[model samples]
Target chain A: MELHDKIRILADAAKYDVSCSSSGSNRENKNGGIGNASFYGICHSWSDDGRCISLLKILFTNVCIYDCSYCVNRCSNDIERALFTPDELADLTINFYRRNYIEGLFLSSAVYKSPDYTMELLIRTVKKLREDYNFNGYIHLKAIPGADINLIRLAGLYADRMSVNIELPSEKSLKLLAPQKTKESIIKPMSFIHSKLLEKSESKKLMRHTDKFVPAGQTTQLIIGATPESDRTILKLSENLYKYYDLKRVYYSAYIPVFNGNNLLGVSSPPLLREHRLYQADWLLRYYNFKADELLTEEELNFDVLLDPKINWAMKNLNLFPVEVNTADYNMLLRVPGIGLRTAKRIVKARKAANLNYDSLKKLGVVLKRAKYFITCNGKYYGGCEIETNKIKNKLLPKSNVLEGQLSIFDSIYKTESNLPILV
Target chain B: MVNYIFDGTFDGLMTVIYVSYYNRQIPNDILSENSYQKNFLGDDIYISTDINKSDKVQNAITTKISKEALKNIYYVYLSELESSYMLIYKYVRLGFKIGRKINYFLQNDIVNDVIKLSQRINHEAYKMIELIRFKEIKKGLFYAKIHPDYNVLPLIVPHFAERFQDQYFVIHDVKRNLSAVYDKKSWIITDIPPEITLITKEEEDFENLWKIYYKSISIEERKNLRLQRQHMPKKYWDMLTEKQ
Candidate 1:
């Protein structure tokens, strides 16, 4: 097949992987190559489905001997199968790159013959992009689960970021859903790569010289609403991975029901709303200072279908809030139902200038309908219809799936930091 | 009995603040050429375009507010705001009176709005790295250009410097002829007359390659044009390496 034909087929197959942030790397362009990875931040792109497409997300090949039940490209599926040689992919990347189509390449694969064969093809493609083409753009290589550690490490040097997906949360789930893969194959490489990143970080600390080692750090993905894994199990596992491996991100792909036959997941798609709630909860865990135990339990397999995670937490722990804004610490402010990072900082900064009243707080970006019930504005109550809980329920809309306005070309061209546009 | 007028520069803004501190309750307005038309006849209107007065006002801010607040004040002034934006100037000045013990103003919508403006400028400049696609010119210099909303041409420099450490490159904020040039080791912001800069045949060569790549990578099944444009807008195509 022509190279263009291969890219069309392979990019479609590869789009599902979803980890394309070219962030956290600080590599610069060398003698003849173009592009570099800056450490401060990287550009991120989101598909209409809201998945980030910051890199040239593609697969080397979709041909698989090992059929993971959740995978769309599994062997039994009649979807087009394609593969790109190392040289062809590099050509396409450089071509797209010079055109300004994508930031870099995000190459993943199904087991093309075997783990080793697939791993070698991936490594060769990256090596060619770096060596033959001298292309220095961001390359996120997906580490095949059963690929040799040696192959993984070599590919690691050429790529800015690498990931080995621990697709199922547990070994039991892996056996039940993706029989061809095992926990050891996944964790062993994850552990190896995680340690190397740690080793590089420690060396840089001692040496005070910047050397590269997976500078974008490592990230992994988990398919939610697949098999029997509960929200409690998923988040607990996510927390452990972050704490243990020092992972940069743990992406939760809401299971899209596109598979059939003995494939594990049930129904058409994972509740996207539930997945969205989990992301908000995940944000709380990573940045907002919430813990796993604070949000979920074994019985609750998913977040409340009606209310968001934070709102549910606030109503359940009603005794904690009505906290004064003037005195509440950053943690307490972050815990407020309607408050986000920008708003929390605003509350902290503005409190320095004047006493916060209900009006002032409203101006600061707190969602008063929800936050008002839980907070006191200068020791005065505002929320709740009659100081009776259920009466206030009518006021706060539960889980409003605010369909975001379509991101216009102009908006993306000049998008500001808040992830919102001034014109919009 | 006087209203002070300034040239709309940050320094000009500070001069007004300096005079206001000395002469309380002065019915004054800060006006830029972009907004100001006629001057009032009766009141003593002092055009304090003097750099020294601007200095005095700025020094007072540093003393009254933290150095951080002074920076905020300067940035808000950079908003290139209309004359009615005086409310922000007053709000920011009030911010100093409250000091570090008073973070409540961070939540003040006016203060937040200005901060967001500075942040947007910074963010747009930074994003030009990933989003500002470049073409290899015939002269062999890798060149990319952008027309971002804020003054991001300055903001995107250190990034291109650290990453493309040993390459010859130019990232021009085409809106302003200011371009960032990296010559192997360091970078310099240079003024270029973009209207006159000749784009050569190599751009055509690279342009065709980029289009082929752009078309090849897109999958029709997930071809969400709205989403594609959401991340890479069409207006940018006028300057992109691959828009055709």
Candidate 2:
């Protein structure tokens, strides 16, 4: 096949694996290297789907031996197939990096011949990019499940970040939809990378110069709504991943029904809003110090479609409302729906100088539309209405069908602030 | 009422702050020569750019206040907003009085305005870092053209210079008619002709491939042009290779 045709096929096949971040790596350029990784990732462009195009995200090949029912690249599906030569992929990455078109390569592939063989191909491509081309840009490699431990270790040395897609949320879903993949196969590699990263850090502390092994750490993706896994279950799993495996991020991809199979959910559209809620919940878990159980309970299996996860949590715990912005701790300020990390920090800093009021909070970038309901400045409430749970819920709900429109990937204010470098 | 006019340089602005400080006279407004309007009521004082005075002011800011404050002041200057000069003046004066605590005085209108303007400039600079796309102009020379709302050429050049160390590239800010030229080792901001076209044959091939890659990567099932426009604003679409 032609090169353009190969790129089209492979890139289209890879778009389903939605781990597009290029941040958290600070790989410096070597003396004669062609590129370097930014500690805070740079987005080269935004795709028509509203996702940030940070890396040259493409599969090394679209040929798969596994027959995952939900995947577009299932062996049963009769789609175009293409494989890139190691040199071809490396040259493309270097050229694209030179033009400032991408941060680096995000090389993922289907299980072509075998897990180990496919893993070897990925290693060779990154090896050529790093050794031959002397490229020091950020690389995110997909660690093929059930690949050799040694091979995975070697790949981690070159990749800034590596991931093994959990594929589905539940073990039953994996068995039903992707019979070829097992829970053990995915978790084993993830655990191995986690251990190796721990060892790398330990060595770096003792020795001044230790070979970087996944310097940006590992991340994983879970396919949401494909199985009967509730938002609570998904978030709980993410919490465990962050705790146990020390994963940098757990990406939730809304299932886009590509193949008509009885095993998959027959959804008309991707569960984007649910995925969005999961991200918000994830942010709260990571930055806002909220636990998964705190965000959702066993009674409420799913997030409220009308409100954000934070707002929903706030409404449930309305007894905690009207936290004094001037006297509230930083953590309390963060719980307010519209008070983001930046704004919360700003409030904490600004309040030290003077007692804050509603007007000052607005100038400090606090989204007063929502925060007014939860905060009191100088012992005065500005929510206009009494803090009744149902009334507040009715008031806070979207006035229009705003959720019908496709949501921007970075719609969450916290997500954008997290992307910015932490202010000094 | 008196208006202070400077030569529109960062140093000149600093000098205006210095002159106002020593004289202990608050100007009704501070304006760059380009932005200055003749008002019958206010007397105009042209403050010439002085290196010594500006350096003294800069040193004082760095020493008395935090380095973070100086950085904010510089970013606010780069914004070139009409009120940026007065905002900086008020901010610096407050910084001198409160030391490093000026940043925490977010309730103060002058401090708040200065911080917001600086953040705006920094945001644009970071956006430029993301949106810059270079095309191979010559055999080994790459060129990119941008028209950012703020003067972010200086802020973004260091990033490209560090990332693409071995490659020669020029990022031209078309609105300002300035280019940041990097030649393997170092980079410098220089003036460039407004209408310089340097597209090579190979550059066209790569551009086509990139456009194809961009198109293929977007899932047709999740097409969201509204969200796309929100993230990558329509104003920047003209210079983007894929959009073109």
Candidate 3:
């Protein structure tokens, strides 16, 4: 096949993974290296589907031996397959990186010959990029499940970030949809990467010039709405992944049905709103210091479609409402419905100079429409009505379609308004 | 009332501060020569650029207030807003009064405006770092063109120079008619022609491949042009290869 045809096929197959972040690595350029990684990631372009194209996201090859029903590259599917030579892939990465088309490469693959063989191919490709080309840009590698622990370790040394996708949320879903894969196969490599990352950090404290091993850390993805797992279950699993594995990010890809055959549930469209809510709750868990239980309960299996996860939580716990912004602790400020991390920090810092009134809160970038229902600036309540749950819920609920102005999935996941454009 | 007119350089602005402070005159407004309007009411004083006076003012700001305050002042000056000059004058004067605590006074309109303008410049500079795309012009020479809202060419070139130290590249800010050229050893910002188009056959081939890859990567199931435009605004679309 032609090179362009191969890229089209491989990139299309790889788009479903949805882990395009090029962040969390600070790899410096060597004396003669071609590129360097920034502390925070840079997005090169946004795709037509509103996703940031940060890396050259593509599969080394689309050929697979496993017959996972939900995947487009399943063995049973009669799809065109292409494999890239190690040198060909590395050359493409260098050419693209030089032309500033991408930050680096995000190489994943289906189980082509064997897990170990495929993993070896990935290692050779990155090795060629790093050693032959002296490329020090960001690289995100996918650790093939069931690959040898030693091989995974070697790949981690080359990659800035490595991920092992836990596609299904539960073991039961994995067995039903991807019969060939086992839970142990996925978790073992993740646990191995986690420990290696910890060891790297510990050794770096003792000595400054240790070889970097996955310096950007690891992230995983879970396919949502495919296997009847509720939002509560998905969030709980993510919280555990963060707490136990010390993972940097857990991506939730709303399941898009690739095969319309038996066993897999049929959906007309991707569960994007549910995915958006899950991401919102994920942000609360990661940055806002809210536990999964605090965001949802056993009785509430799914997020309310009308309101965001944070507003929902705030309405439920009305006793915490009307907290004085002037005197509220930083943690309490974060818990307010409309107060984001940047605004909360700004309030904390600004209040040290003088008391902040409602007008000043607006200038600090607080979303007053929602925060008024929860916070009081200087002992004066601005929430016109009483702090009743239903009244606040009615005010906060979306007047239009909830999905009309929804944020792009990746952009809204983090509270950093670093990407927001300034209006001239 | 006196209106201070400067030569539109950071040094000139600093000299304006120096002259105004030594003369003990509170100007009605501070304007760059390019943006100054003749008003019959206020006396307009054209302040020439003086390195010695500017250095003293800069040193005083660094010693009395903070280095961060000086950075904020520079960024606000780069913003080129008509009010930015006066805003910085008030901000620096206030910074001298409260030491480093001036930045924390977000409620004060002058300090708040200065911070916001500086943040805007920083934001645009960061965006340029992300959105600038280079095309291989000749075998080893790469070129990119951008028209950012703020004068962010100087702010963003250091990043590219560091990342592509061994390669030859030019980043042109078309709106300002300036280009930063790096020739494998060092980089310099200089004037460029208003129109320059240089492309190679190989560059076109790679651009086509990138356009193809960009299209293939977007999920058809979730296509939100609004969100795409929100993140990557339409004003920047002309320079983006894939968008074109």
Q: Pick the candidate with the highest TM-score.
A: 3
Please write out the lDDT profile of model 1 over residues B21-45, one tens digit for every residue.
6666545565665456665564645
lDDT of 3 at A91: 90
Q: Put down candidate 3 lDDT per residue, B50-144, tens digits, no spaces.
A: 99999999999999998989999999888878888888999988998999787789999998888888988998897788788888877888889
The digit string of per-residue lDDT tens for model 1 on A1-424 reads 7665666677667755656667677676778457665454344444434234457778888889977778878788878777777877787777665544567888898898889889999888888888787777788889999888998888788878889898877888889878988888989989999999888878887897755667787889887777677888889999999999988888876666656666454465345656556666777788778888889866566776566678767766777867888789988988987777767887887776678888877777776767787788788878745544465555665434222211122233322111221111
Candidate 1 stretches greater than 4 Å from native: A28-33, A98-100, A128-137, A260-266, A386-389, A398-424, B1-27, B34-74, B84-104, B107-113, B123-153, B156-244
DockQ of 3: 0.64
- The number of clashing residue pairs in each candidate reads 19, 0, 0
Per-residue lDDT of candidate 2, residues B3-42 (tens digit)? 9999999999999999998888999999999967777787
- Give the chain B TM-score for each candidate: 0.71, 0.95, 0.95
Instruction: Tell me the DockQ of each model, to 2 decimals.
Output: 0.30, 0.64, 0.64
lDDT: worst 10-residue window of model 3 chain A: A415-424
The CAPRI category of model 3 is medium
Candidates' C-alpha lDDT: 0.68, 0.84, 0.86
